[model samples]
Target chain A: MTSAPPATPVPAGVRATARIRATADGRGGTALPLLTGEGPLALRRTRGEGAEAGVMLVGAMSAPLGGDHLAVEADVGAGARLALATAAATLALPGRGGAPARYDVRLTLEGDAALRWLPEPLVSVRGSDLRVRTRAELAPGARLLLREEQVLGRAGEPGGLLRSRLTVTRAGRPLLDQELACGPGAPAGWDGPAGLAGHRSLGQLLVVDPAFEKAPAAAAVLGEFAAVTPLAGPAVLVTALAPDALRLRELLDAARRTYGW
Target chain B: MASSLAALLVLADGRFPAGGHAHSGGAEAACAAGRIHDAATLAEFCRGRLHTAGLVAAGLAAAAALGLDPAELDAAADARTPSPALRTAGRRLGRQLMRAARATWPAPELDALAAAFPRGAHQPVVLGLTARAAGLGPLDAAHVAAYESVGGPATATVRLLGLDPFEASGVLARLAPELDAVAAEAAAAARRARTEGTEALPAASSPLLEIAAEIHADWPVRLFAS
Candidate 1:
């Protein structure tokens, strides 16, 4: 029988280390701070009157549940760059206004990774923007499943919004860099004809599943959402527009079900 | 004033070709879905979007063009766009316009702006860069910026709805007085720079058009990229 690893206790005065593990929604996430030659990450968090500035060097990870948070600040050291960022990621924000509230985040994924970081949408209005700037250097036979999403506003409230930006580069070249800001007023922002198409929330699933990549025959199944365009490379994007965050999540999950993530 | 008029003419020239054909300004997909059917409705849609997305983008561009510091303008516009696709398209359009403007007329600031926003800058930023490059004053730049932005999509509707060119020009001609009025306000905005909280718009609601634009990403075949 496998025993679950214990949760690392939060240390005082902006510091903590070792292999970090966290969970939310019954799913556990782990982030290894020391990247091969990258060395140890540093996190600095300063709490003030109404705001807090936290920066992570080499950085760290956070539990996806709203009740838990991992904040830090640190300048990163340079090293050999890779392609995909495969660190298990789970983030969350618990409303603390005593009534209800919302959060917005901009997460950047930079540095070395496997192929290109294309996460399925994992947005929520306890909001988080998982911005990533990654340089992918894959060694072949490596698998990647990137789920990205924006959950708008508080579920109980009639109005809520979330915005996110993510960028992935490979071999010092841009592969996929996207900034998504979706909320209640989003549909009306463009006076656009296809403006949000009447949906308050959205999710996208990016799959580099070996089966889909190797077969090449699955082209027909994948061709519907992706094409050879000068922008965004030929990666399939299965997205859903819905009024509720859960509904959008459901749609994205269903789409990825076929990929076997 | 003559400089302003010339600036307006230059900026409003749809034929100038800044890759304008690639984007419908949200009109193509909207019209395809039957959300924006006619001129009045389109105008209504424009006013609403101008207040939210359009106003934010233009405001940022105007602020930058007026010499308020490019970094501030970038942040202001970045704060306003809550939609990733729209922002991305805005940057693409801005880049295309910068490339086209530079090829036709080389301006140092325009070149700098192109460098600053290598990946993408909003449309207004490109206009301000070009206007400044053309030696147009801030007010002059503002007039050109507001008018061209409106004109580009208006022209699209003409082809989309079979509205005659003369008829379309007539509508625009009729809109000249209103344009002048709007241009005056935009010129004022160019003087100091605007924050994300402030916006200029004619009040109207077009929920359908906005929704259509959001859902356009799902469409199987798209004529215009944006």
Candidate 2:
């Protein structure tokens, strides 16, 4: 019996790029002069109330397979307000390449502008590896509300390797910078008491506003596994852990309501 | 070398009066929630804390000990800490540590750090500077920090849960090898930061610890301050 030929390594997955630029129309309404989507990242303009402009992220195809490079950029002009959301949760899937997938998100807010980035959860499926990095630059008067949720795996399956980093800066000074690693290949004891503490899902909500500079948020616990605390800068952070995605979202929603978001 | 080693021991000692005894390093909250009910769970808690928060703190301390700018490291520490409660506790502990460090080993750099942050810097940053002032190297600083990260929580668990003292000590004893490895990794990261900048430092975080710390801070009646 002859052994089959060794499998050939596939080339890198798709390199997708998407961008959105929102500006105020000077009459309290927002204008989206730039909306570009490529590969798996699709941007669609949806109706929004008040002076805010809504943009929904629609996945055009299955993407972020191993070795894929994806990037999304959003720029909110002065006095503009932009609210961005995802149509559905993102699934990280395994591919032929041994390399991990990469997703980079860059958000910029000009003076007096505001942005709300409420994307759906990113699920780490078994055998997949993904690295996500998010960077936000805010002007002094700008405000930002961002949310991130991660589910370890689907159903009873164990999750793959997942690493995420978040960095936020205001006027070129660091406000918040943190990284989290989960699943296989992460440091040992990550699921133990001091880490995720046996939780399968985790989420965080970041709220930055000029008003917070005047009166910082008072620290409080929103649930059994969730709490809200103010940052040294003009921001408030809510962090939570749950057994499932549904419970994680519920905790975050409760925190948002408590903060009047 | 012998005096420096003594300094390392003094710095790592719980009786050093750094006010670390007042903080449980999230063990109090975990204890209250029944997550750390005994020696085994306490060991699990310490193991997790050792790898995540402990590693991060050790990296910062190592960087500081390498003679990096205290102000920059303090800002980096602030960036890495998302929970305001933990940040506040760190600064208070930093202040207490700074006072002890200055009295024990007077140095111009320590004076400058205190002047720059009158309120207090982050505890890990102060610890690194203290190690520097004591003629210790980055590795020594990392070792001190890595041990402190779990030591405080381990000691606190004994008080909070009334666990066996010998078991608590055994948990720490069993973790000695891991502490050594974490310190080495942290020191290497600090060495990388010399050329790569503070961004090279470890940013690993434990989400549950941050959340629990915030909750613990608001507890009307709690044994530990954080």
Candidate 3:
């Protein structure tokens, strides 16, 4: 009888990694040559528009609990296009470990490549602590459209500790680097007048296009709580705050339509 | 390090001709939107600004005073600031402050900064370089930045809402301890950044301030420039 291999023991908290690599096919379409997922991070290929490869993030189990370490990396080669989305909102919950969970996302785009990262909002539940960091590196002539949203808490909860940082570099130069801290243990007055101003939901949409180098986006307020501004580089950033997640997505969607993206 | 305390006073003075008086630090917009009216709301606004924007500005100033590259620090400041209107305002104020610094304390670094930027660098960068030129330490620069973060808005609130001057000043006075703590934290961050890199500096953000500043810039009739 053939002996079955011993099952690997899973760690206490989840340690997951998801990787994706997209390359351009000869016929002007994109193909994912590599797609890997481990532990709770599951990656599924989905149908995308012409010339673009779409990947949907599917959670295989309840993960990213306190003390969990999750990482996702995506690389788009030259002339390739990729779209990434999430199946549902990620909920950060307290675990037995009581340590802060960490989620890191790294993206790389080669020459003339494009990436659209549209993930669902991350909800910080009560008594949970989560830190998320996203870094994107783009080569010359590359384009990126990234959207991130955070819902402070669920319906009647005050939420837990959440810290998020986004850093983007193009051609090895700094484009945008910002960090937002909310919920418990953040700086004082985070929800005060100059911070969220009593708003619960916050999000940002970043668009980096080489074409913006010529005709940059004009600085304008998109709504009462949303404003669009051009960065120092050839990019535009839209920041918005709302009372809830649905309204926050509406604001960002409206901004997406404004740019026809 | 022994330095001229009077120089710190002069640089931190609200009456100094650095064009800060023309900017409300988003207080004007808050008042217009009714987010800040009485002294209580004003205090809350100032505290929020102090912790987020104030902390970031103080770190940059402290790093610059420690003799970090002004060009790199300016770029870092640009990366931190996501608003074009705020960027313009910062440069404009930097230009104005550069003129004042050149007259007050002449330094080759300041001259090089002015020549390199031509238009101007970010104000906190210029402020830190000015503090260096004045023979001040990084903590001094951090203190000046922390003070100015709340001072501008406090002064503007007095004018915008017609709040009691004593109350406005009291609000600032009550924030003295927090200001000192922020300045200390900023100076420490700057020290770490000096060795580790500019990424070590704080990047705390105030979204409402940024959003309101964008809307304020488009105001046809506004008392303040930002």
Q: Best DockQ goes to which candidate? A: 2
Chain A alone, model 3, TM-score? Answer: 0.94
- On the 0 to 100 scale, the lDDT of residue A57 in model 1 is 29
lDDT of 1 by residue, A1-261 (tens): 598889765332212322211111112212234322122223222121111111222334332333232222121212221122223323333333222222222222323111223333333444332222222222223333455554444455332333344333223233343444444443333323333444555555554333434453122222222211112332344544567766766766676675524
DockQ of each: 0.16, 0.76, 0.68
Off by over 4 Å in 1: A1-145, A151-157, A163-194, A206-239, A243-261, B1-5, B13-23, B38-128, B137-149, B162-226
lDDT of 2 by residue, A75-159 (tens): 9999999999999998888878678999999999998999999999999999989999999999999999999999998889998
lDDT of 2 at A152: 93
What stretches of model 3 exceed 4 Å from their correct place? A1-12
lDDT of 2: 0.90
Cα lDDT of model 3 by residue, B60-137, tens digit:
999999999999899999999999999999999999999999998999999999999999999999999999999999
Clashing pairs in 2: none
Estimate, for each residue in A1-261, the C-alpha lDDT of model 3 and write its tens digit.
699899865446778899999999978999999999998899999999999999999988766899899999999999999999989899888877678999999999999999999999999998999999999999979999999999988997888899998989899877898889988898887888888888888999999999999999989897778899899999999999999999999989988887636
Ranking by DockQ: 2, 3, 1
Query: Which residue window of length 10 is worst by lDDT in model 2 chain B?
Result: B1-10
Candidate with best lDDT: 3
lDDT of each: 0.46, 0.90, 0.92
Error of 3 at B197 (Å): 2.5
